[model samples]
Target: MLVQDAKNLVIERGGVLNCLGPKLGARFDYDADLRPLFPLIKGNLANAQLYDRPERVQFLLDGILCTIYAQEVVAAPFLERDQVLRFIHRLTATLNDLYTRRHSLGRNHRKTTMLPVYDIYRLLPGTNCTACGQPSCLAFAAALSRGRSYPDRCPGFRQPIAHHAVYPVYDQNGNLVSTLEMELAADADELNRQAQPTREHPAVALLTAREEEVLRLLAKGASNPEIAVALAISPHTVKTHVGHLFDKLGVNDRTQAAVWAHTHHYL
Candidate 1:
């Protein structure tokens, strides 16, 4: 199992939730090395959001916010301790399932962005459609931008698919500060407006299917021989793949390649 247990579950500032009627934010520390699963979750789950640097992953499910890190998991707005415990149990099972099926899932390491409220507003039907339970399209747009609502809420909304666009934010030293990610509408006008953001990062060269498999295994600390055996390939072929990975990733050795995979959330 990827995550055997979640320990130290506790409510944080339980009283602040009084107005919200006993809603609780619970956190628990764990021992799982979930870095390798980040890419799998991000690429496979349509609703999940991922970030690097400190490595945080989050998704909204059933109106609950579940945030995961390398060593801990947090879920919020539960009614009681039992609810939190049940959530933790379900989350642990889900993580374990994701890890078990990691080999079959696709991987994506692209940066994510937060869309502006107005941009989100443009994607809606703009009919002042209160069918989504919101008074106005602008109000619904605000909820969508804040991750408090989803695009499917609007019945007249034609395109509900998420389109990811990355815009790198840099500081004066040209060091990357953050990457802005947004779900774009299919409209051409939306794309034109989105093009205004500065994109400093060059397009990343994607890895082939076999190369991705090899990299994932390598990141999991598998030796070359183990990778060869797992992939049913010759040792010489595995060595060649490793060499290619080193060259493509601009890394010197296997350890460096593994580090790169982790940093980029490829693992």
Candidate 2:
């Protein structure tokens, strides 16, 4: 593996990230020189930004912000201890993959800037889908430009992708900044409905908002009582919601419900 150990794990608390959904971030210090892998990362990730001066690459993965410096890696929105381990594993695997294939990949040194917020907003589904936890598409776009958000956070970018097509954007310096995958020729009304928070998944329309919340908690391995406490509801109500969720999702048990939630991205 390119990065085997993180010498230290630093957490940022009550910091700037509180406004961005999480109150903490994770910083991993490593001994590997990540400079050579920047080109491979830039070519792979949609929002990768490589800087030559400091030798770093910043990108988004699974809605989490990641930055790879020459000898360190930082991931944010505060992952749990287990989540941090998984993140490190994935990070190591990604870096190792890039290192192993570096010979076949072309190297690039061009510096690219982030696309304008308006430009990103224009590419969004324009549904004001708050599923990304942002209030609006414009707000999400601004967050994305600042590397605080990712495009896939938009439900419009997540589900029912009937077709795929690349939409390229160039920086002010005429350099290709992003080649985002945009849904093409999709039914507008369906996309809008799916983008709605209460109906993020195609099957979610069959479940109530409370049931959806319960299902998500269950998928996280929360017990009925735990879910009740988390949702500020009674245990009986939580059970009822779980039952309704199972029925609506066509599942027989909690395990099946959890599997369904995961299969439909409710988790």
Candidate 3:
């Protein structure tokens, strides 16, 4: 991966980027004989993996986890390809850092031994905030990998750790057009607190007041013909409201619709 090495690695890939997309996705081909750098990959990326496919690997590039294929890759979008390109540049820079360095790496540097801690620190925020009850972020990462530390100590990682979440979506202007939220992990006994169900749920906001009255009556076992009489509306108008209710509630039958009302306390 020398600066002048044309054969280092240049992938052919394509992908899309939406203003409000979940992730930056791309598909690209790697050389058939991909390097066996699992340890190095893990040290540099928050997420990295080597699978049964000997010639392929997946790793985080910027915010994207991109797959480098040995034999096949799928076309995606423009922004995704750009991220992959930047990833290639970073990989090259890493090679430059590795090659010209004079430091003594542990002899043989086999996977049987732990990953180098300094490398582990590379992926961290580098804040050295001591927020994880460790002297430094590096110590925290090592403790985490070794199972000596739980994920909750890092307020930053707690929610994602609990849910195995994807990062939030971003738009082309780098705006947060959509949000993915994760709640902090609660104590083991938090589930024991009993909570009362409340009526007039948020879904009611989607319907007009008149429509909500119709749903309440429907949930109370009123026939469509009966509802028309009580609401002082024609049967045809009642049927129209029922259809509207079904569309908004996403229910196919009277029973399912009634169940929704009961679950949300609309009844």
Task: Give per-residue CA lDDT, model 2, range 1-267, as digits (tens).
Answer: 366777787765422222222335577787878787788888876667775334578777665667777887767554466776777777778778878888887666655444456567656677875787666676566545434455656767533223344555556686766665533434556445434453333234335456667889998899999998998888988887776565444345675566456545677
| Cα TM-score of candidate 2 | 0.40
Weakest 10 consecutive residues of candidate 1 by summed lDDT? 197-206
Residue-by-residue lDDT tens digits, candidate 3, 192-221: 221123243323433545567778999899
Off by over 4 Å in 2: 16-21, 113-267
What would you estimate as the lDDT of candidate 2? 0.63
Residue range 13-67, candidate 1, lDDT tens digits:
3322222233566778888677677777778765577764446776664556676
What is the Cα-based lDDT of residue 148 in candidate 2?
A: 43
Q: Whole-model lDDT, candidate 3?
A: 0.48
Worst 10 residues of 2 by lDDT: 14-23
Clashes in predicted model 2:
0
Pitting candidate 1 against candidate 2, the one with the higher lDDT is 2
